[model samples]
Target: MRNLRITLIFSIIILTISCKNKEVKSENKNSNIGQFRFIISDTLAYGKNLARISEYNRKLKENESSVIAVIIENELEDGSTKIDTFSDGLKTPFFGISKYQTGKHKIEIKVEEKMMRTKKLPNDSLSLEIKDIYYTYKFHVFIKDKVYISELNEILSKQMDIEYNENPI
Candidate 1:
């Protein structure tokens, strides 16, 4: 009888502790958990532009969030595709160490201007054009050593679309 009472008391204490600061988790895709984001210079990413690209990769390492972005072509209603990114963050040269973020959260960004791209021609003619962009993603979250997880692949992440120059130069 004493053992049963002790076990019941202990279980209540554990349940009460677990209720604090609980994360909203779900296994569904619409569960709002798997979103992640990062602001990477499109110039360095593509093989086209070299002049505007910095040796900055060797000089300075960005405080890059661990979100791998998979951009796809945006299909328009007219059967034309456009890169439709509009960024509202501070348009600054990508620099400085970003702040550390909590795991399983996503980055949300508001855009003040639509993002665009520019091309320099062989005869020094500059062709400026806007790209229609769309994105899909794969997720990877770095869990700390002491953390526990009931599910791994279903983990979600997010980041703000800040510090990216629309047309890098």
Candidate 2:
């Protein structure tokens, strides 16, 4: 009867410890639920004018599944614009241009998983532009005009590298 009592006491102590540990883990998991954000930039120049490229904001959130959003803004007048959204299985690209004859413009992009509410990985963006120039002669002098065309490539090469290092996706 003494051995039976000792065995019951040991089992009760073990069960109590397991219940406490589970509570601690549940609290830790709740503390990490939120969205993350980052920023990126690039530049191009021609003659006396300069074109600047910067993202509005980069954000990732955990919902029914993982969702990533990228916001891109351009600060140039007369230049064009473009946006691209990318993931492991799909790619989407969009294009636009400045509204006025000269000034600043913006474009926004959002990406999310089809279904699920869990953790999410990191994402990337690539901005590119080609400037074209035309010249005409008047009064034995040359006059030059320029235009900008923009494109966004949804290439996740850098993200792949990070994943290769055993980092979060």
Candidate 3:
């Protein structure tokens, strides 16, 4: 009986995985993906720590689908690099353009979220706030070139319902 139960459970799990993959493959054939590209034009290398704060302002409409969140990383000296992410409802996205940066850094900047939480407020709350967790970003970054942080483009974004508290000070 024990062996039979184990085999049955294993078979069910395998079947579930195959079913989900099939659905995703069919969905992708009709998906319309949006793309945003920026070119950083700084190529001078120096020895020092660098840090900069930036903002992300993109308005996601009701039920507007978003692709993967992009990560911009500046590899540091101790095998550690500064990283920032851009995605839907990313409240605060701060980066060091290269903080305490020991050397010159890369050409892109993305914001970091200090405090991001999704929870239902009290029943007596007066506001209809929707804190939706769309999905964890599929991580990808291009090691293009080294540049200063000032060249980042600033744009206007919409307000979100997610409660963001911390400031990256």
TM-scores of the models, in the order given = 0.18, 0.24, 0.25
Residue 4, candidate 2: C-alpha displacement in angstroms: 43
Tens-digit lDDT track of model 2 for 47-141: 12211122223232322222222222333445554443233321121222123333221223232312222222457322222111111111111
| Candidate 3, lDDT over the whole model | 0.30
**Stretches of candidate 2 exceeding 4 Å from the true structure:** 1-34, 42-83, 89-103, 113-169
**Candidate 2 lDDT trough over 10 residues, lowest sum:** 18-27
Q: How does residue 67 of candidate 1 score in lDDT?
A: 11
Give the candidate number with the greatest lDDT. Answer: 3
Clashing residue pair totals per candidate (backbone < 3 A): 17, 8, 11
Off by over 4 Å in 1: 1-35, 38-86, 89-115, 135-169
Number of the predicted model whose TM-score against the real structure is largest:
3
Better of 2 and 3 by lDDT: 3
lDDT of each: 0.25, 0.25, 0.30
